[model samples]
Target: MKDIRKYDLAIIGGGAAGLTTATHVKRCKDLSVIVISKDAHISYSECGIPFKLAGKVHDFDSLIVKTPDFFDKMGIDIELETEALSIDILNRKIELENCDILFDKLVIATGGKQRIPQPLQKYIGMDGIFTIQTLADGMKIESALLSAKTMVIIGAGAIGVETAAGIAKRGIDTTLINRGPAILSRLIDPDMAEIVSEFLKSIGVNLITGNIPDSIEGKERVENVLISGERIPADIVIISTGILPDVELAENAGISTGELGGIIVNEHLQAFVDGNFSTDIFAGGDCCEITDFITNKGTLVQLAPAARHMATIMANNICGKDTVLKPLLGPSIYVAGDLLIGSVGLTSKRARSEDIDVITGYATGVTKASYFPGSSDIHIKLIFSDDRLTGAQIIGKSGVKERIDSLAFMIKKKATIEEMLSIETCYAPPVSTVVDPLMYAIKDAFRKIKART
Candidate 1:
């Protein structure tokens, strides 16, 4: 007989969303909570993996924010290395490899898995080829880095580019390949990506864009990758193409998924099943599709911060609080060498793709007073639709993250150019300019709007 366990709330995932929901629920109510995770470690920062490899972070152990023991001490039952095979929606039971768990309410937060390009699918699990999705994967790459002399990273997304930069900084020859015409094509416009491309090159990373590898050649290990009929030698190959939501379990249980392949949930985070929203079943994180703040269309946001916010909303709803998840702006920031790149909402390219007519404004200034010792050049771009702030992109040695965050809020509130122009800003010689770069960017937009009208 299979061992059967029961709890008031059973969360199927221990990543950012699942664990956060578990802790929040426990704090709000005295309900018995259990978290099941397929991965051995949970509560670790996936974003820190590249930095750890680059020697910016001390070690992998430091990336872990909490352990299973900590959850146990908090009275939250956690099952590590336990894969949930399927869910019986009618019975409210989750079937696992070793046991069957019953729950009064359930939260699905399966997160995402690294997407392997079709050309390299067959070479998965082969020696010298890797994907960093978990602490275990990062540790393996760390070990392999000791012997790796040359590395080829496929996909020029944040992870791929950051890893390439980090590995190259370690003195390893690195090549970054992207199928798109520019790196971070989804995050920023080609113009902004050019800046990042140059920075990566300055740090010794070979950039290859607008091409796909024809084949990965090697018997026991990856020795070379053929791209554009050109063969490049490689001691290691890392795939950072993209991430797909893990929704097989939810689909198998007859839960509805959106066009983006993520579970369809309501604003309250309740999952839709058989064309009806289930009060007892909820979904969040990368596994669920959320609405875009500007378009109000379903989209998948795989960032950890978005996942945690969804988790909080889900927990609040479960605790009988009337909390709802607002639409997502999908703000993101990345570190490549000494540059901090950030973007929020839609880029000009994305807005055009969505058929949105937009006007853009650009400004270049210094992060601090020109005479300040460590002042660096900062570039800002603002995208506006009908004079309302829609998106922003910023690149510099510093001051990018906070500005992106502020712009995200403005976009969420539908701030207008006039409103942005009148906003107050703090100034300091060491930390900021007398007139912030964002102010200049706003002024630039205002000028464009005035000229057009």
Candidate 2:
């Protein structure tokens, strides 16, 4: 029989969630903890890849928040390049290639995998074709950029748009292709997306909306991409369609998954098996399903901040603290050129899909007093349903993130337009207008609601 290593806690990933859980567990309890990761590198900022490529960040090494040495100092054991083959829930043992791990408690923080559409699957291993999900992936793309003159990025989600903006700013002829008519179709409404789309063009990204790549043509490496019978030259190709939860190991162990293909977990971050929650097994990060604050339905939030938050909650529960995760608003912010784009909760399209009757309010103003020096244009959109705030979108050179965060809180609290109108705000000629853009948006919503009444 092979020797099995036993631990107080075993985390199945080394990404943001897994490392965070390990650290938090050590902070609360003096337990034997180990993190298993298939990748060679760990604890790096996956979200900073585009910024690094764009030269906004100095180097990829700086993206690494913690090294194994740092974890060692914290008394956490890490097993790099170790993959979990399967899980035996009844035995609490994880089968690996050369060994097994027994644990008193197990955390499934498998994170997510980049989504490659079926049509593009054949080109995945081809030279000059890439996806940016890991530190290695980002490094590979960076190396390719050294010789590439033109680049084509497929999908216009946040990653795609950010990558296009970054690459274009580097003097590379970059093209962004989106199947939807508007970029960031899921994040913001079309009108707000137009503001970003126009800015992308102004910064030299060749925008191609409402089209899909027919094929990637190359002899041994990428030469060009075909879309609607037009061939666009490309020295390299990046697929940024999206990410999907990595729940294979969990599914193989008989864990239940939600419709979104993520492991189903309770409010306490406990994993489920055949509809019953497991006390010894917990899951978090991009691999687990969480509730949408507005809709109260299962949703996948793949952002790093959400993953860290979930890890903290899971750690508390593991330490015998009765803490529960609050439903998430799925707030997100992105940079494009000089603008900060942000959105929280649902868009009008998503609301209608959920059978929600939504009314919207729009306001355009300056980040500061109109006459204030260095003031920049700001656009706001507020979405309300049944007199309560449900969502918001903002695009501006400044104040976008703070405003979006405030709206996320309002949506989570189910604040009504009336409540929003009565809230107090601060004003500085250098920082904000006397009447914040958010107030004007709320007032607009109130007027619309009154008209209906």
Q: lDDT of each structure?
A: 0.92, 0.93
Tens-place lDDT digits, model 1, residues 252-283? 99999988899999999999998889999999
**Clash pairs of candidate 2?**
none
Give per-residue CA lDDT, model 2, range 1-453, as digits (tens).
777999999999998899999999999999999999999899999889999999899999999998889999989989999999999998989998888999999999999998889999999998999999889999999999999899999999999998999999999999999998999998999999999999999999999999899999999889989999999999989999999999999999999999999999999999998669998899999999999888899999999999999999999999999999989888999997788999998899999899999889999989888788999999999999999999999999999998899888888888988888899999889999898888888888889889998
The Cα error of candidate 2 at residue 152, in Å, is: 0.4
Residues forming the 10-long window of minimal summed lDDT in candidate 2: 410-419
